[model samples]
Target: MIVRVFGFSVIVSLSALAVAFLYRGWTGLALCAILGILEVSLSFDNAVINATVLERMSRFWQQMFLTVGIVIAVFGMRLLFPLAIVWITGGLAPVEAFRLAMNPPPDGADHFADGRPSYEAILLAAHPQIAAFGGMFLLLLFLNFVLGNRGLTWLSWIERPLGQLGRLDQLAVVIALVILVVAAEYLTPDSTRATVLISGILGAVTYLLVDGLSSLFQRRQPGGPDTSSVPGPPDGDCADRTDMQHGEIRSGEPARARHRPAPIAAAVGKAGFFLFLYLEVLDASFSFDGVIGAFAITPDPILIALGLGFIGAIFVRSITIYLVRQGTLGQYRYLEHGAHWAIGALAVILLVSIRVEINEVVTGLIGVAFIGASLASSVRANRRDGRHAHHEAVRTH
Candidate 1:
């Protein structure tokens, strides 16, 4: 399974390394390699969140994301997107932007020749707006998930209350707006207040538009949303295993429904078109920090962008495939909970970073901590349930 999934990723990574060597010799190769590791470490939770969505997609769309999406990610987002930022913010012509990108300034230098802003300088200047948008979108995602009623959870104490409040209409939006206002008015600097506020609002609206369209598209499915096929602890079956354990039956649903394969709603069709858009937007948000942060290593825009795909992008895609293919969510029931919680933390960190510089390592560790704790909790629950099942079998025998 590992080889089948990661074989392509390995090939892509090697090719990228060779390109790096050819482009700038050993220095480019080393820097690109380090950036790859940095991206993977920082974006691990992104893979988990992405798997939750990808599992619902049909095979065609899933493969599309793996193939075509990689090209878009590498060239469109990694390469052209940064140049756009530099061009727009720094007021440079497209060709000039491309030229300046090729000749990046020295490390930590804000400007290059004639005191013009460097590509990195423009990106840093744009960070506040970037943070505002990505942070708000992610914050809303976390809120929407926790607000839904669910059977399995790692942090019941908090999640339970949020779930209870879910009945209120658009409660997540109300809360997000309030937080955004507070952050913009009080937290952000006076010079960038309007930009930050407007960006944050755009983020919230974008989430609503994309997510709402996805749900609307989902309803276009012939039989409605296929909620019954995923045989996990969700829907109140088992906290650690499939609900159909020991031939047990869930009332109101056929045994075959639980036994059916992963729910594939034809993502290549209308049912998944908007969902695909949502995933792309989510991927962009995940890469926002990494794209900006790569400057600390080297200012060469070409390497910074290509470096992401060298190893990081492919590995993330592969991990998402593994999780869905292996049904990791069903095996470790609280994984979804962990991933969402980590997203909430990351959202807050992104917002806070607008006022104060937060280390990327600190951001990564916080997410890992939340996921690790949830994994431990899930292990305990599984062990306890297994022992109970064994005792019940012994008595029956």
Candidate 2:
């Protein structure tokens, strides 16, 4: 399995290099490799969350996800999305945008007709749209987390009537529309107001559409075990027997055989896909910040791709695997929570970058700090639990 995974990764990397070679030879290959790495690094948490979801999926689905999903992520989101945004915003045709991006103006020419592409300069150019995108994204994330923690019942008063109307999804649409209007009226200036509004609406609509699709897909899959009914171990020796019996029951089945998912499993699967989409969008949001920030380093698209792509992808995949197999989540439940909160913070940073500037390195450090703190807390909890268990065992004996 490891060979297959790495083999596929090598094939993809080589294929990207081959295409890059066709265009710009060593330079292109170098660019692709770098951008691949950048993308991987920026999206490390995304891969971890993806693995969490993948663990619950059928082997077939897992294979499909790794193969097809990576393509979409690499090409569709990373490369094409930026080009599309640039085209739409710069008022250049698609081909023209590609050309401009691929062949950026030479350094010392004042590409924006002002000065060097400083962080302030890029932030000034991208702040409005970034702010809009980040603001709405963070707002939704905050609401989702808060409401989710409330058991989603707090929403019952609002959702019940909407549910009866069979248009709860429309509520999100409405909020997005309101945001669109507000952006048009106040957030965006006359020069770029239309573009900002369009992009904001696009982001919101995309979010709702992706969320709905993920939910639907989840409804179609088999469910998993009922977590609520997962009884605690029986007292004394019977506990061991019960655990053994459970192990025996599970061992009786073939690993690859299809089984109807229990409700909890189904919910988890669905939640996983939702998270997958969230991570994808979140990665894109982070990339937007990085891409814009990269211009400060160098606007040469080839260099950006080279520097960010290859190195980024490898680390991200490693992190994902570490999160997935190490049972970090199961062992340190709060770690996932912290990561998600970091995502929320990053989302806000992306939004705030539209109006104010924050260094990408700083952004990364903030997330790292949160993750590190969560990890430390989890480790402490584990040690404490271990000591408590020892004490209990001694007392019982």
Tell me the alpha-carbon RMSD of every candidate.
3.8, 9.0
Clashes of each: 0, 30
Over the stretch 206-319, how does candidate 2's per-residue lDDT look in tens digits?
666665555566556554332211111111122233233343324333221111111134234554556456546755655566666665555555545544543354345545
Q: Which ten contiguous residues of candidate 2 have the minimum total lDDT?
A: 228-237
Clashing pairs in 1: none
lDDT of 1 by residue, 1-397 (tens): 9999999988888888889999999998998899888888877788988888888788888988898788777777788888888888888899998998887677557787688777777888899899999999999998888876665556888887887887687998999999999999888999999999999999999988888777777766775453322211223324213443334435434322333333334554776777778888888887877787787788887688768865888788999999989988667767777888889998998888888887788888988888888788777776776776677668779
Q: Which stretches of candidate 1 lie over 4 Å from their true place?
A: 106-108, 226-268
CA shift of 62, model 1, Å: 0.1
Model 1 is weakest, by summed lDDT over 10 consecutive residues, at: 228-237
User: Candidate 1's C-alpha lDDT?
Assistant: 0.78
